[model samples]
Target: MLLNLPCTIAPRWRRLALMTLLLSGLGTSHVHAFVLDWSQVTWNTGSPSQTFSDVQGSGIDISISTTLAGGFYNTPTQDNNQNLNLFPDWYSNNGASSYIDVTIRFTRTVTNVSFSFEDMDRGNISGSRPTRYYWEDVIERANGWNGSSLVTPTATDVGSNILIDTTSRPGDVLYRGNTNLNWSPDGSFTLNWEQPVDTVSFRYSSGSRAQSNPAAQVIGISNISFHSAVPEAGTLWLGAFLLAALALRSIPRVPELLRIRTRSVSENS
Candidate 1:
């Protein structure tokens, strides 16, 4: 004698199959759900360097300066002298050789922030000129902060600030050379040792004079921008789909089995 399976099992199985399909589709879509909110600022100056405040609030500030050729003083022969003093009130230094101090003030507490820089100008030079620049964000941890204790991001390679090759043609946008800081996003990007901070400073120079011209000028940097990190809608949908699928999978088997048995008895009767 052959026993017939309950018809209710067919409907339950179809539901499970449908749920699996929907979940799979959702997961696939979620894999591509990522958003990047980036902004940039540029700075140039006729003086050795200049500083600007309220970059993130009013809008990113771009500073430009004239490139001084044949200024490479050491092993690096290519030196394009253009500096943007990120912190003029607090720190002072020679051009392109020392760290340019920057201050970040936050109204609220924050944890992480990312920064990117671009070489707006490069001196006309050739052959292995070491052009170096760096971006750093200093954080104030307590009151009456001294020096160096301020937390800063990893320094980029020298002559490669914002990681753009000045020797290369021009108009090259390089993101690798910039500094990226990870902290809570609830605070501002300003430097206020009493509070929190997320700021960026830059430095650049050529390696050799043979690789640059004393009168050569280098320039290029578009913008620097920032935004809060929020997951894409697809991510939310995928999460919901997975939750639904898991819930469906977790349904008590006993109830389903009982339903199937009742359906069978009713059909036979």
Candidate 2:
């Protein structure tokens, strides 16, 4: 008797299970929010200013500020700092004795960020590994909007400042040596946060007190990549609710089917 009852509802039960499986799957994955192509991105700059338009496909409201001594410049032929084109553009410290501060601001919040560095002045010397240099950096985050500035950063405008080593390993600096000049082969740092961020700043400086190489003062900023996370919880729940309603709609038909089965059994008897 139990076997016969299950056979009567088997098709409906299978349909309900399939629907639930698909709807619940929505809760398990993430979607990409944005990707910035530096070459295609818009740009505007003045003596102490630089703007990256439409970053992360959000209409390009991001901005960067350099010290009076630091500013933006493009390589002779290449544009779009997205990757290592033969000729690339860059933002530099412009001979600042101290670290050059580059502050980045976004009109919308960003969740994950990856910054790429290209060598504008590493000597012509080619090697199996990236040479070590004297470089240091600090990355900080903020909640609201802030203008670019060369002045000292404040806690009100910037969140906690996290210092990061320039080298891939300890006791060393200027450390990436891959020859590809492409994004992955170059030097880069990435940050992932559970919370959204509106502002990010980087302070950079490299060189020894005795050395006067122009490359030491000039750091190449090759590209910028950032993205926001998509919201999926609502979709998951909505799908589940609709699927549940569909299963309920199937329940009423079960009684009609049972009545037909019982009538046939009586007729046979």
Candidate 3:
């Protein structure tokens, strides 16, 4: 008849053995880690003299300034240096729109990407629903590259479908209503989006409503970046298993060496 081992002892030994196997596997498999590198870029637009630099690809920065119209008492001014104006219906009156476009390049493949826009401020210009912000992700078509026809994925604000609406007010932040829109005291806004696209192009429109005086415009971007996720748990486990197998193969000789040492010790005694 065989004697039974203690229940506590068996479980403890099994756990230790299992942990060793797991760690060995982790050491064998090669895993890649990704980090965002956003250290070269700059943007500035309009008055209040705003500027931004060293932006990441996954993030964005924005700036805005107001101006007074000429000869008219309290008439809105336009920032002519960057061709941007802050008054209502400015784009329509000037026959032009104020905007900025940034192109970002990627070397490796990225599956899922998250984007954030910062410093979207319209100031304290209270009026009937002034649409001052627009954001979208532009991707190149898989087919041939056309200078004019670049494929654009549909962008949704909050949960509502997004359209070129100039009637959106400062308080109205979401493209739909389900997304979070944070407003800062300095007249800035932040918006985030999650989309899987190969190439990303950011377009900003400021004074697109004016037709005649289309000089005043203001806009900026910063903190643009992207990162790849680490490998899943299965990958790590497989690595551990391979390492454990190697470890076991070397274990057979350990007992023999121990036995030889025991004999040598006895002989010396």
Candidate 4:
């Protein structure tokens, strides 16, 4: 339903009502994609540091923490959120595995968000059938390629990493790469989604031995990209209604219009 305009409004003001209805479209708020930008941020680095604060970028904020003894976060080396060091590692072998949790919060709900999981070849606890997993989402791109390392789908060590069983948990990811401590310079894949999303995360765990950890434990993430969210249907409707109402109120009633015309005619006579 819309704002009900009085039918008795003078005919001269009908155009005003029409314009008000059209102006309501402005409330839709068609916004463009917002890529996370970190060129202005200044962050520190440590392998599971004692403490690190959250960082903010264009249209987004990021928080990184750990439940175990090792984790890492670095400011991007390049602009537009490139080369961000969000990898995982462990310093102590207290019978616990390595874990890292990264949560990216958007200023508002966005659609089709995504990022990259890079340099996941091997880790400190590399061994046969090691328990390793990483969780991510919101974009579509093939694995085995990051920029410098992977070229073809059949490239060496392309499918070396085996995906573990995650049927029970859809958000879980299992990976078992080759024995090489550092397989490729940039062995990685991407997860993309096309629907509406507000917040996304990256959670990782590994049973690789803490004593022999390598560069493989350093998993970098590319900048996330997504379009802005649209307003809800109710909000759009209400805005349109109010605009129409205000416009109609300024219109003179039929009697007032008639009196003005009559006065003009008498003066001419």
* Top model number, TM-score: 4
lDDT of each: 0.33, 0.45, 0.34, 0.45
Tell me each candidate's RMSD, in Å, in order.
15.0, 11.1, 13.2, 10.6
TM-score of each: 0.30, 0.44, 0.34, 0.52
Clashes of 3: 55
165-217 per-residue lDDT for model 1 (tens digits): 33332432222223222221211122112222333333333222222123322
- Candidate 3 lDDT at 230 equals 38
In TM-score terms, candidate 3 sits at: 0.34
lDDT of 4: 0.45
Q: For residues 1-269, what per-residue lDDT tens digits would candidate 4 score against the true structure? A: 01122443434366676766676665766656655544444345433322222223233444433333354434223324355664444443222334555555444455566665555544423354255322211111122222233221211233334333335245444443334334244455556645555445545544332333333245555665666645566777787787768766776778776766676567668
List where candidate 1 sits over 4 angstroms from the true fold.
Answer: 1-7, 23-203, 210-220, 224-269
Across 61-137, the per-residue lDDT of candidate 3 in tens digits comes to 22222322231112223232221222222332211133333344344333333343332333322243344222221
In model 1, what is the error at residue 268, expressed in angstroms?
11
Question: Which segments of candidate 4 are over 4 A away from where they belong?
Answer: 1-17, 37-40, 47-60, 66-81, 86-97, 123-164, 167-171, 175-186, 207-216, 230-246, 249-269
lDDT of 2 by residue, 1-269 (tens): 44455776788878888888877777764646565555764444223565666655555466766542233334222254454222212233222343445667777666555454444223333233234322222222222232332222222111112223345334322322222232332334333333456676654443221123323223345565566555577887888788879888767476687786786677668
Clashing pairs in 4: 48-71, 124-213, 125-208, 125-209, 138-192, 138-193, 139-191, 139-192, 139-193, 140-192
